[model samples]
Target: MTDVSVYTDPQAAVPTAPLIETRKLTRHFRVGRGLSPKMLHAVDDVDITIDRQEIVALAGESGSGKSTIARLLAGVYTPTSGEIYFQGRAVSSMRSRRDQLAYRGDVPMVFQDPFSSLNPAFRVSHGILRSLKLHQPELTRTQRNEEAERVIEAVGLAPASDLMYRYPYELSGGQRQRIGFAQALAHKPKLILADEPVSMLDVSIRIGLLNLMAELRRSAGVSFLYITHDIASARYVADRLLIMYAGHIVESGPTEAVLANPKHPYTDLLLGAVPDPRAPLSVAVEGDTGEPPKVIDPTPGCRFRWRCPLVVDECHHVTPTLRLLGDGHEAACHVAEPDAGMHATKP
Candidate 1:
């Protein structure tokens, strides 16, 4: 595999509004219909953004609302409240079929499992061709075929002519995953919501895929919302990192800065969990064994207080909001002080 390191064009101009932005986005699910129906807060009051040609990693453990956010951005699930703005336009305001189709084409999704994302019965080019047909209906049959081959080759699958005719089961896992990217690329999207695209592959294969993403970003000017539980991979490919805990964004900042000085206890716990094979192991941090709370009709308070070692009185009654902690860093915690690093204590 080529070097996994990504090159950033430092001189690239920033856009007026972000490529995509969410304002207090929230999605809830009603479970067990009865006299009293309960609301499961899948995502709650989350605000996030992805700039043009930028890669933002939403990193967290399973059930942290990472995938839910990706789905919301992809328009698979409607938000119970809040608004999604793409290029400063509210998504909900797009009433026409043309506008809806345009939005879907501009914001394609790549699911976690490449196998399920592709149809085993059809040839590998099926998805790419279909996406082209939807987004570029003006193109003729020959043009669609050419476009499909172009995207397949763009994802590093050389000799797209031969590869496009092959079945999904015939290709290796990495190749199949690349085809998934090809499908997204075929849409000519501005931002791709990649939901753990590399988690199913081997470590060596994962690097190649990561490099492909970097190459695509460099060559195509496409922004990505990369969702994953793997922080190390996120650090390798993402310019910015947002850490979510129990359906809320706990911390967010530049990837290196967030890892170097995690202000939130949950962020610290996630970092501590990643084992370093080179270093000798020591006792685990206190509060590492606790489980995340189930978000069924949750009470109003800081969600992490149950497992937080630095819990304070304010954390139990009042929910914490993300406060700026300098250097573009923000954390949603009552006890974490600005510039205090992760060693913050309760008064």
Candidate 2:
């Protein structure tokens, strides 16, 4: 394992204030019949902060509330409780239309499906031109078109003139995704919510996109919230990692430290699942059986207790909060407390 301190330097010269922050952000939904509707806790008391130019990766299984958090940050969904602060202003307090539009312009999203994001009716340049018109309305048509071509080229699409006329169906998956990045860059956004942007692309093309994003962060100083299940890719791009489970962030810290010495059982499980060529064929790593616990009207104890291998009596009664481990690392597990010897191990 490479030393994280030498490789990932997210903390170097970081600003004191965060670019975006959440204070006990909670979002719930009502499901089932009207007689007794269940409250689904999609995000429960998630407090996170992202500094400028920092790449923070949110990793978890599907339906673990990663996308929900992204949506909340992108202003796609309203939170039931708590607040989302961007540049020290409350997102919910932006009552005026102008304020909302300004907020949207500052924070753009790059969705998972590149094909669906780009409209087939419009050319590749049309999407970026539209964003330019919306955000940089003062610019003339000629200026907007030039800006579009520049952004397109910046995302690695060469010969912008030729590619601008191509439709979504005319471009390959990688090209279409590049167009998505170009569109996001049109607004010169301060932060981007990348929700599994590389998951749908081919393995060969994924690295290129990751490198593109990393380059963008370096050149543009844009903060990113990269949501994905692929821990390996997260480690490659992200400076820090936040592990989500059952709608809660169970563990968070510097990416390599968490990977090298996972404090939470769920984090350990996720790392154990990663493929290792050196391991024997007969030696298999297995996760907990049974479906994940229902989020609707969840019990008081730890959300992961039902599936946790280190479940103890206290885990069933006490809802563990994120406690500091060391050097900004935190975990929400009673058994895997900071002082406990819960080092990385196969699950």
lDDT of 1: 0.87
Instruction: Report clash pairs, candidate 2.
Output: none
Give lDDT tens digits, candidate 1, residues 109-202. Answer: 9889987888999999988888888888999999999888888888889788999999999999899999998998888778989999999999
Q: How many clashing residue pairs, candidate 1? A: 0
At residue 243, what lDDT does model 2 achieve?
Answer: 98
Q: Candidate 2: where are CA atoms >4 Å away?
A: 1-16, 280-282, 339-347
Best by TM-score: 1
With candidate 1 superimposed using the best TM-score fit, by how many Å does residue 302's alpha carbon deviate from the native?
0.7
Tens digit per residue, CA lDDT, model 2, 1-347: 11111112243223455789999999999989978889999999999999888999999999899999999999999999999988777888889998888778778999999889998998889989988898889999999988888888888888898999998999999999888888888878778899999999999999999988888887777789999999999999999999999899999999988888889988988888888999888878776554586689988888887677777899888889999987888999887766444643324
CA-lDDT, candidates in order: 0.87, 0.86
Give per-residue lDDT, candidate 1, residue 347.
30
**Each prediction's Cα RMSD?**
4.0, 5.3
